[model samples]
Target chain A: MAPVKNGRYLFNEIPSGYPIPGQTTVYDESETIDLDTVPLNGGALVKLLVVSIDPYLRGRMRRAEAKSYNEPFKIGEPLMNWGVGLVLRSDSSSVKAGDHVYGYFKFQQYEIVDATRVLVLENKEGLPWSAYVGVAGMPGQTAYHAWKEFAEAKKGDTVFVTTGAGVVGATVVQLAKADGLKVIASAGSDDKVEFMKSIGVDVPFNYKTTKTAEVLEKEGPINVYWDNVGGESFEAAIEYAAKGARFIECGMISGYNTSEVYQVKNLMKIVTKQLHIHGFIVTDLMPKYNPEFYSSFVGRIGRGEIAYKEHLLVGLERAGEGILDVQSGRNFGKCVIVVGEDKA
Target chain B: MAPVKNGRYLFNEIPSGYPIPGQTTVYDESETIDLDTVPLNGGALVKLLVVSIDPYLRGRMRRAEAKSYNEPFKIGEPLMNWGVGLVLRSDSSSVKAGDHVYGYFKFQQYEIVDATRVLVLENKEGLPWSAYVGVAGMPGQTAYHAWKEFAEAKKGDTVFVTTGAGVVGATVVQLAKADGLKVIASAGSDDKVEFMKSIGVDVPFNYKTTKTAEVLEKEGPINVYWDNVGGESFEAAIEYAAKGARFIECGMISGYNTSEVYQVKNLMKIVTKQLHIHGFIVTDLMPKYNPEFYSSFVGRIGRGEIAYKEHLLVGLERAGEGILDVQSGRNFGKCVIVVGEDKA
Candidate 1:
């Protein structure tokens, strides 16, 4: 065949705190990869379909010297993250050309990757292809695992979820509610608060207008705290936590982009209340829980028991903007960059 | 029996931050309690020997409206705490007049208390009467229970103890070392650091001079963090914690007296590192661990396998100063106020 020009978003500079537009540069013709070029030992030429934009990607924009779970993105290299793609060509028996796949891959329109790294998506079951990058994706799995393993969520237990309208938080809210938990969710705007309420959240408050402590005192003595937005919200949860409460530290989006850290004063209450604060990454649970995730979690989504929302940005060029939108709480749900239409 | 004139320290005023001298008043001949005015049923008249001055007492000095596990001290009433005492008079079957006992009692020269509230000391074993208030008492039990139940301490594990030379911290240091764990301890003074070193702490740093993060980085990838002096030290521990590390939040003595809370900036690492931070009050474990604590922990103390230090101030009049000293890290080891000679 012929050579194709690949459009990719490159990490141009290390951000001081938040990533600005200049830090991520879009190159429409960053590289040319010949379709004839196949792996010497069996790899795949994948065309990117949907790319996920998450809060954690912000940490990758920092200097390489900054220690984190994920390595910093190398300047002048294409950003790499979890995304769904179509196998344009394959040299291995694991996957064939035109097979839908999902795994860790570069944030580019087209690329050649090792076939073994990507998993072939077998069953779509009338769901949108973007669902694999949202509800049945990393973020959804994170919410499920955190709730199952870390939350210790019980029926009739009152749970407070921060960033309640966002992807992971929204999933957690629905899961908790479905499991008979009394859900109180916090969002940044009136619209987001309404969205949380519409999803059967017992009490949804706009955190921008209401003091978290006031809402907690009025509606809480929270049994489980599903933390997505940390800092002041975390402090408030500590103050309002019930005796023997479990605090699931899922994400701290509030402090990820800013240098100014919120000093949590009520941590002492954690002792007085006998609180257990646990931090976790979803990927760590994949080996054990992925099977259950695929069977039970996917079944729940298929049966309409699980509900999900997505904020899609078309084109690879808007990948940086999608990340910034998620970081700034401008996106309503699971933020994704729709690089190409699903041709399957 | 003659009427006894008691010298008592009364809680005069609620403190905004640290308790000032005037907040606590030493009233000599405060009240005349006639031995004849015994309980309508049965009671004991006890003369205080050594009163334990602890950091938790700071919480008691707050306004009555402030909710806490322990009740606030009533203004103009004698300050009450854990003290070892000689029973001057008893009308109950549990003990005689000459018997020594230890439990929660008024911080005065003499107190008329119910017989059921105190436990008679059966085995002194050549240990100091003050040892009942220190090493073999509440503080020692606290250290033991915190380590056994909370720390999840294992051999070869690198454990970091804050306030390393203080009562609870010193005990934790010795216990961790005895368990075959590598111990990194932080103290406030050069003398305290030396004390920590003498007690087999693998690395002891004065947190006042050297940055706790600096010392932790130099000596750690700490597995178990036994936090006593919280605030900055706790923040530092969060920074250097290893993945799946356990942070036993025993106390935050550093923030107790001060209104200014330290903003813990590195708490986000708890998620990245998959840390479990649990807060617990030692009293909560008393029912479960107290028997084992009394048997094994006390046996260890008696055998000299356990070492303890005390910064004892003479007389109940100096109770306020003793508290201030402990709060400021001016006094080393367990801060105890020796109210009267033990005539056992």
Candidate 2:
């Protein structure tokens, strides 16, 4: 068989700050693979359907020696993240042809992968294929576990969630609202703030124009904080936290691309107000929470009780642009790239 | 009944930085009280025996309007803190003449206080009277509950503790050692570091002479951090914290007395490491933990399985100096003042 176009995105450089579009990560249509003749060797051949572009992927664009929870992206190789794909051929029992699967998928149209690396996805609820990589996926699980276990939230509690229009924060904001909490959320743009308001956020503000601390001081003594964009907002949360406030530190997107990271001045408030600031990665809790989250949240989302939003980028060629959109706060909701045709 | 000398310490000013020994807090012996026939309406007339001087008091020295976990000390009034006292006279059922008690007692030779405020101190282990205000009291409880509940510790875990020779840090160091942890403790003085070693600390360093971050980088990726002094050390702890590290924020004495507070730069580590930083007051957990702690620890101390230390300031005239000693890191152990003879 002649080598067919694979169309992959490669990690080109370790970013010093915000990744440069087309330079830090590059999409090369010239890359190809022989699907029919390539050696499977007890592995499965899969056609990538949807690839998730998330803020956390920015942390992976670092030197291999830099230590973190996730391994650094290998330069000149396909940059990977949570993705859903259609199993085209299988040499193992876990996944079969025509079955939809999800796992840490590379940014490419086709791949030969270990059968064990992919989990067969059963879309019995008949939701969008992209939803599996969005609300019903990593972001949803992160919001669910961190909010349920660490927020220690109660009815009538005032919750402040940063990055309110983003996938993780939007999920938490909705969860808090459903649990009868007063939700105050923030976003970089006015349109995102409007989206937050549409979803029943009690006080939604554009942090670009409004002072986070002023809003919190006037409308809060925040009982719980779902922090995604950690920086000045984090310091403000610390300053306005009520006694025994719970802080769920999911992401620090504001400081993710900057060398001159924000210095938190009010950390002393942690002692003065007896605050509880907890940081967690969703992967750690996924083994226990994924099934639970999917079981409960999928139906709610299907029935229109919980809303899920996405910013979709079509084709593998746009993968680099999608990630830059997410990193620079240009993308709204759960940013996803459609890499191949969704045959499912 | 003739008037008798009633020596007392009064709050004279709101300090800008470290409390000035005689100006911020003053000891006056010119006032007198009628001890023979003092009014005791549903209260008790008590003779102050030993009064505690702690770093946390620096927080209470603020203006009355500054909200914190504990109320600010009222200016022009007798400064108050945990004290052991002898009941001279009583008009309530809670206490009687000749009973030894402990409470938030005034810094004076004699005072008429609400009888319910003071609890009868039954020294079943035959410990020193001053021990009730030191290791067997609030500081000890702070160490015990914060360590047991929040540290999430296991055997052989490396633990870092700041202000290692102070009551809270010393107690936590001993507790971690007993739990089979590798204890790394820091203090301002070489003498205090030696004291930490004597109490079974595996790694004891004088933070003033040795760089805290350098030592932590060399010997640790700290699994549990019992933080008392929380400025530069707090930042260093965050930098060196292992994945899933637990930070027990009992006090921020480093920032308590100053307007120029330290800015923490490495809070991003909280996310990358999935850390849990919990700040709690000993008062909040006392109901559940105090009895449990006393039952286990008092016996341990009595049997010589645990050791206790004290820095005794003789006479009521030295109360101001004692507090300054605590604030400035001059106190080697639990700072306490001998206000009157232990008539028990």
Maximum-lDDT candidate: 2
Predicted complexes: DockQ each: 0.74, 0.79
The residue pairs in collision within model 2 are: none
* Stretches of candidate 1 exceeding 4 Å from the true structure: A21-23, B88-99, B124-126
Model 2 misplacement above 4 A: none
lDDT of each: 0.84, 0.88
lDDT, candidate 2, A23-97, per-residue tens: 998888887788777778898999999999999999999999988888999999999988999988888888888
* Candidate 1 lDDT for residue A72: 88
| Candidate 2 Cα deviation (angstroms), residue B22 | 1.8
Instruction: Report the lDDT tens digits of candidate 2 across residue range B1-344.
Output: 68989998999999998888789988888899998787898899999999998888888888788787888889888999899999999999999999999999989999999999888987888888888898888888888888878987799899999888888888898899888999999999888888888999988999888999999999999999998888899999989999999999988888877778687777788988999999888889888898887788877776767777899989988888888888888888798998899772
What is the C-alpha lDDT profile of model 1 across A233-252, one tens digit per residue? 99899888888899999889
Per TM-score, the best of the predicted structures is 2
Give the number of the best model, judged by DockQ: 2
